[model samples]
Target: MFDTLIDQFWSLTLSGIALGFIYVLVSLGYTMVYGVLRMINFANSEIFMFGTFATIIISRDFLGNVDGSKTLPLPKLLLTISLCLIGSMIVSGLVAVFVELVAYRRLRARGTNKLATLISAIGISIVLSEFMRMITHSRPTLNPRILEKKSLFEIAGANFRIDTVLTIVFAAVLFFVLDRFVKFSRLGRAIRAVSMNEDASKLMGIDLNRVISATFLIGGMMSGAAAFFYTLTYENTKFNVGFTLGLAAFTAAVIGGIGNIRGAFFGGLSLGLVEVYASAVLGTQWKSVTVFVILVLVLVVKPSGIFGEAVQQTRA
Candidate 1:
C-alpha cells in the first residue's frame, strides 16, 4: 500500500492541479459577481452548463461526428477545438448577461430586499437547470475524443498527459491576463471603484449598469472556458452537472477569500489538492465530505476568507 501510494503521488498531484484550475475558472464567476454586486448569482452554474452544450453542438458541427477510434488531423483538431471554445464563451457570456438584465436588474432598480434578490436568483437557477434538462432530456452530452491521452513526459514514475499540461497552462494564462486587466485596465478601475462604493462611483460618472453587466459577462466567459476544459477532460456533461461543480467552486471562492480573485486562485488549488488526497486516503465517497469539512473549518477560523476582507456594504 505504501509503495502504491508513493507511485501514485505525482499522478495525483498533476490531476489535482488540473482539476484545481477548473475550480479557479468557475470560482472566478462567483467571486467577481460577489465583489461587484454583493450577491451570489446562483444561476451562473447554468451558464456553465450551457457552455458545455454549446461546445458539444459546435464541435459536432465542425468535426461531423465524434469518432473516438479515429484521430483528427492536427490542424482540423485545433480548429474544431477553437471554434467550440469560442462558441461556448459567446453563448455562456450572453446567457449570463441576459440573466442579469432579465432577473436582477429590475430588482436592483426597485431597491428590492436582499432576501428577495436571493430568492429570485434561486428561482432563476432552478428555471435554467430545468430548461436544460428539458432540452437534453437529462442526458449527459459527450465530447469527441480528439486528443487521446498520450504521455507528454514522466516525473517520478508518473506519466503526465498533453491534455493536463494544456489545461493548466491555458487556464493559468487566462487567469494571469484577467488579473492584469482587473489590476491595471481603465475598465478594471471603474469596476473596482464601483465595487468599493456604488453611489460614489455613480457620482464619479461611472455607468453602474455597464460595470455590473461587464462583471457578469467576464465571469461567464471564465465559466465558459471551464466548461470547455471540463468536457474535454471528463468527456460528458448533464443538465445538473453544474450543481456539484458550482457548489465546489463556491466553496473554493469562500476558502480563498470570496471577493478576491487571487484568493479564488489559491483556494481552488488548495481545495483540489485536499479533495484528491482525501479521496485517496479515505474513499471516493469521502471526497466531497472533505471539501465541506474544509469549508466548515475555514468559516470557523476566518469567515472573511483566507484572502477576503470584510465589506461594510453588502449590496451594490
Candidate 2:
C-alpha cells in the first residue's frame, strides 16, 4: 500500500488540493460565524445543502438541460455556471440570514445563555435538513454537468482534469479576494472590531446586528460557491450529503484554529492532504477515521489550533 501510494503520490496530491478547496470554502462559514458570535451555526451545513439544490433548480428552470455528452461552448458554459453561482449564493445567503433572524436573533437580544443558542442552532440544522429531504422526497438528485471534464494537462504522469484545475484556480482567487476584503475594507474593520470586543464596537456606534448579518451572508456565499463546485465534481446531491462534509469542514476549522479565517484555509488544505495520503496508505474506509484521529491529536497537542490564539479570549 505504501509503495503504491508513493508511486501515485502526485495524483493523490492534486486530488487532495481540489478537495481541500471545497473544504476551505465550507470551513469559512464555520470560522466566520465563530469569529463574530463565538458560537457555531450548525445550520451552515444545510445552508450548503440548499445551495446545491438551488443550482439544480436554477439550471433546470432557466438554463434548460445541461447535456453531458455534448460539450457546451465556452461562452455558454461560462454563462450557465455564472447563473448557477449567482442563484446558489443568493439563496444560501438569504437562508443564512433567515436562520439568524429566526433561530438566533431573539436569543442574542435577550442575552440568553450560550447553551440556548447552541441548542437552537442544532434544532435549526435538523429542521433545515429534514425540510430539504421532504422537498426532494428523500431522493438523491443529480446535478447537470455544466462543464465536461477534459484533460487540462499532465503532471508527473497524472492527467489533471479541466474541472479540477478550474475549481482550484477559482477557489484561490476567491480566497485572495476575501482575505484582502477582510483585512482592508471598512466593513471588514467593523467585523474585526466586533469580533474582538462586541461591547467596545457597540460603544463605538457599530450596529451589532448588521455586522453579524453581513458575516453570515459572506460565509453563506462561500458555502454556496463550494456547493456548486462540489456538484460539478460529484454530479450528485442527497439530503444527508451535507452532514459528513459539514463535519469534516468543522473539523478543519477547529484544526486551523476556530475563528481564524486564514487558519480555516490552512487547516482545510492540510486536512485534505492528510486524508488523501492516509487513504492511499491505509485504505478508502480509513480515510474519515484518519482525519478525526489527526483532529484529536492536534487538539491534544494544541487545543487552540495551529492559528488559534487563546480560545478563552474569543469567547464573549
Candidate 3:
C-alpha cells in the first residue's frame, strides 16, 4: 500500500483536488444557508440530486446522446455542455427555492422550533430521493460522454485528463466569482447582513424573504454545477448518490467552519486530499471511515474549524 501510494502520489493528488472542488461547490450551498438561517439545509442534497437528473435528461433527451456512442463536432459539443450546465443550474435553483418555500418558510415565519425545520428538511430530502428512485427504477443512470475525455498534459509522471482539468478550473472560477459577489454585490451585502443579524437587517429595511430566497438560489446553482462535474467525472449517477456526497460536503463545511464560505472551500479540498490518500494507502472500503475519523478529530481539537469563526464574525 505504501509503495502504491508513493508511485501514484501526484496522480492521486490531482484526482483528489478535482474531487475536492466538487465538494467545495456543494459545501458552499450548505455553508451559505447556514450563514443566513443558522440551519443546516438537509434538503440541499436533494437539490444536488435533482441537478444530476437534469444533466442526464438534457444529455439523453435533448442532445440525443443516449449511450454516448455518437461523437459530436467540437462546436456542437460545447453547445451541448453549455445547455446542460444552464438546464442543471436553473432546475436546481428552482428546486432549492421551492424547498425553502415548502419546507422552511412557513415554519420559520411561525417561529417554530429549529428541530422542526431540520426534520422538515430531512423529510423533503427523503421525498425527493424516493421520487427520483421511482422515476429511474432505482438504477444507476449513465451520463452521456459530452466531452471526449483525453489526457491533456502530464507532470512528474502524472497525466491529467481534459475533463478533470476543466472541472477544476471552472470550479475555481465559479468560486472566485461567488466570493466577489458575496463581498461586493448589493444582494451579497444583504445576505451578509442577514447572516449577521436577521432581525437587524429586517429592521434596516432589507427584504429578508428575497435575500433568503436568493441565497438558496445561489447555493443551489453551485450544487448544480458540482453535479454536472460529478457526472462528468464519474460518468454515472444513482438516485441516492447525494447521500454520500452530501455527507462529505457537510463534513467539509463543518471542517472549514459551517457558516464561512472560504472555510468551506479549504475544508473541502482538505477532506478530498485526505480521502484520496487514505483510499490509496489504506483501501477503498476505508475511505468513508477515514473521513469521519478526521471529522471527529477536528471537532475534538477545534470545534470552530479552520476558520475559527462563523461567516457573521468573518469577512467570508
Candidate 4:
C-alpha cells in the first residue's frame, strides 16, 4: 500500500486537488446556507444534479453538440463552453431559489421547528432526484466532449491535464471572488448581518428574505459551476450522481466548520488529498471508508471543525 502511494504521489496529489475543487464548490453552498438560515439545505445536492443536466442540455440541445463526435473550432468551442457555464449557473441558481420558496419560506414564515424544515429539505431532495430519474429513465447520460483532455506538462512523474489545471484555477478564482463578495459587497454585508443577528438586521432595515434568497442563489451558482467542472472531467453524469458527492461536500463543510467559507475550502482540499492517497494505499474500495472515518473523527474530536465556530461567530 505504501509503495503504491509513494510511486504515484504527484499523480495522486494532482487528481486529489482537482476532485477536491469540486467538493469545495459544492460545500460552499452548504456553508453559505447554514451561515444565513442556520438550516441544512438537503436539496442542494439536487441543485448540483440539475446543473449537470443543464450543462448537457445546453451543450447538446442548444449548442448542437448532440453527439460527442463533433470537433469544435477554437472560437466555437470557447463560445459553447461559456454558454454552457452560464446556462448551468442560471438554471441551478433559479432552481435553488425555487426550492427555498417551495420548501422553506412558508415554514420559516410560520416559525416551524428546525426538524420540520430539515424534513422538508430532505423531501425536496428526494422529489428532485426522482424527477430527474424519471426524465432520464434511470439511465446514465454523457456530456459532449467539448474540451479534449490533453496533458499540458509534467511535474515529477505526474502529468497535468488541461481539465485538471482548469478545474484548479477556476475553483480558486471563484472561491476568491466569492470570499470577497461575502466580505465586502452590500448584499454580502446584509447576509452577514442577518447571520449574526437576524433581529438586529431587520431593525437595521435589511430585508431578511432577500438576503436569504440571494444566499441560496450564490451557493447554487457555485454548485452549478462545480457541476460544469465535474462533467468536464468525467464526461458523464447520472440522476443519482449528486448523492454521494453531496454527502462528501457536506462532510467537507462540517470538517472545515459548517458556516465558514475558508474552512469549507480547506476541508475539501484536505479530504480530497486524503481520499486519493488512501485509495492508492489501501485500494479503491477504501476511498469512501477513509472519508467517513475522517468525518467521524472530526465530529468526535473537533465538532467545530478545523476552523472552529459558525458564521455568526466568525469573520465573514
Q: Each candidate's TM vs. the true structure?
A: 0.95, 0.95, 0.97, 0.97
| 1-316: candidate 1 lDDT, tens digit per residue | 2453466888888888999999999999998899899888899889899998888888776568568667778898789778888888888899899889888999999998999989998888899999999988988877777678788899886577878888899899989988888888888888888888889999999999999999999999999999988888888889999988888898899998888888889889988887777777787887777788888889899988876754333211
**Candidate 1, which segments miss by more than 4 Å at Cα?**
1-6, 309-316
Q: How do the residues 184-274 of candidate 3 rate in per-residue lDDT, one tens digit apiece?
A: 9999999999988889999999999999999999999999999998888888899899988898899899899888999999999998998
Runs in model 4 deviating more than 4 A are 309-316
Alpha-carbon lDDT, every model: 0.85, 0.87, 0.89, 0.90
Per-model RMSD to reference? 2.6, 2.2, 1.4, 1.5
After superposition, which runs of candidate 2 have C-alpha atoms over 4 Å from their true positions? 310-316
* Residue 115's lDDT in candidate 1: 95
lDDT of 2 by residue, 179-244 (tens): 888888888888888989899999999999999999999999999999888888898899888898
Where is the poorest 10-residue window by lDDT in model 1? 307-316
- Between the candidate structures 2 and 3, which one is better when assessed by TM-score? 3
